[model samples]
Target: MQTTKKSSGWHLRDVIMLTLIAIFFGFIFWIWAFAYDAVAATPLKPFANDITLGAWIMAGPLAGYLLRKAGASFLGEFLAAFAEMIIGSQWGVSTLLSGLIQGIGGELGFALTGYKKWNSFSLVLSTLTSTIVTFGYDLYASGYTSYSLGMLITLFIIRFLSIGFFGGVLVAAITKLIDKSGILNR
Candidate 1:
């Protein structure tokens, strides 16, 4: 008799879960655009993107932790962005590019760990990498390079905080809840 190991590829249930997560977060991202605009209109406009970025980053880490697959984080973030575009996001097609960038950013941390650790430390690393990746993109795409060095430093700090809170802490909490619910065991 020959013995065979199970394939580690994505299954139907994983696809369904990923799609559901994308749709939900896509709508949330669309709604967040309005909030971003509102904040941009304020005196704190300079820091608005940093303030609201964490929410936009949630889906990647959330899906990564939940699915524990190699490309889950990237697909989660990208599909969510695609969904936001479909839902008439103010940013239109640019949202897709952002999603791609964000997805790669979110995936790097897990990749670094060989996709082994899904704990708080991994989450923190995810946030840090996401912040750095997104910030680098913003420097060129969003004209952040025009800002003064001090302002740039301030923006980096704010971005890290935002990503940490939403993508790291919040994701950790939500995953804990899901773990407690035992749905993944099914």
Candidate 2:
């Protein structure tokens, strides 16, 4: 008799869970827009977006950590962007492109782990990749290329810190809470 390993494909439950995550984060992203605008109006306008970017991309890493599956991060981030768009985000359709880029960045961390480790290291890596990927995107898309090298460095540092805090620290906390609540076992 031949023995075969069980496939780890996504089920309906996973879909529902991912959807809920996307919706929740989508709403959060929508509200975050106002906060972004407020920050932009300050003297720190140039770095405001970088400082607040981590919160915007949290859904991807959060979903990847929770789901522990390939493509979860991408789907989570993309769907959240979709939901944010549906909620009438100020960025309009451009949000979708951001989501796609962010999702790929978020997914790269787990991909580096071969979809095996979903711990602090992976989360940190996610933050790093997200910062790099998003910053790269902004170089042309958001006109970061026009900035001085010093300003670029400053933006990168701020972006990494922001992503590290929200996508790494906060995500670990949320996952820990979920684990403690025994929700996944149900």
Candidate 3:
């Protein structure tokens, strides 16, 4: 009989899987930080900054899909951010905070499903959720609220598209690839 890890909370396999996912994204996030800085320095910074936001949101859903549990996404994203900090992320401790918030955003989607559903709809919802929380955080933490309403709207749209594509669609594709390996089936 195949036991459900959801009702049992997390198993060792779940933890291991989440950890591996987190660690991988930690490195990616660390590298992405530099890319973000490079883009910020370019003339396109005004329009491109939000475009880069999605890269930060991937670990949560990827981990959640693999683990299929309530806190998997949050823990994965948190650990990933922790790794990014240890990897010398430019934002230092703030990166950790961002992870926490972003993880919550990812968690929110699954939570809305009452921890029952793990489908494409949930993934899209997860992307939208992360975009809202992270962008909402940025408004105050990053002083985006001081910007003009038009700029804020533009950033909002860009951030949504970025997360929708990179965090949502890209993560889904990666998850499908991993799923095809039958690792979860085993």
Candidate 4:
């Protein structure tokens, strides 16, 4: 049988697990930041670079699914971004704001479901929303606004697909594996 928490507050285990998720994904984001930079240096940056944005949003759904609580997505993603900051993101302090916005966007999906939908569809919706949110932020922050309209639309599509795959599908898969481990009972 599957387990789910219907509690109202955070517990010690939730903190520890959430922190672990944050730390793990934070490191992932840090590494991805470098990877994105390297990619940005190439000709591919004009069209395909936005795909990498997907990896940055994983912690939100991962934590939300595991913790099954309000704010899990936001807290998890925010801390992960904070971790990326400590590790020295190329975007500097702006990574924190990006994390905050992306996380809140992720939280919006679960919140709309009343915190009860922990399935693939919900995760997909969650990631899609985060993509839009972050992509919108990047339009101004990353100077994507200066690109042609065609490139902007292409970037949006790439980013949406990337986040949907990584943040939604990939994270859900990992969480299922963790559930099968019989570790968190979540």
Query: Weakest 10 consecutive residues, lDDT, candidate 3?
Result: 1-10
Alpha-carbon shift of residue 124 in model 2 (angstroms): 0.6
- Tens digit per residue, CA lDDT, model 4, 81-134: 988888888778988998898888899888888988888877977987798788
Tens-place lDDT per residue, model 1, 1-186, is: 011123457788888889899999999999899899999999999999999999998999999998888888988999899999999989889999999999999989888899999889888999999999999999999999999999999999999999999998889889999999998897
Q: Give residue 159's error in model 4 in angstroms.
A: 0.3
Location of the lowest summed lDDT over 10 successive residues in candidate 1: 1-10
Model 2 weakest 10-residue run by lDDT: 1-10
Which tens-of-lDDT digit does each residue in 1-186 have in candidate 2? 011122357788888989898999999999999999999999989988899999988999999988888888988999999999999999999999999999999989889889889889999888899998999999999999999999999999999999999998999999999889998786
Would you list the C-alpha lDDT of every candidate in the order shown? 0.91, 0.90, 0.85, 0.82
- Candidate 3 clashing pairs, residues 3+ apart or interchain: none
Spell out the clash pairs found in candidate 2. Answer: none
How does model 3 score by TM-score?
Answer: 0.92
Candidate 1 runs further than 4 Å off: 1-8
Model 4, position 15, has a per-residue lDDT of 80
- Over 4 Å off, model 4: 1-8
Report the Cα lDDT for residue 176, model 4: 84
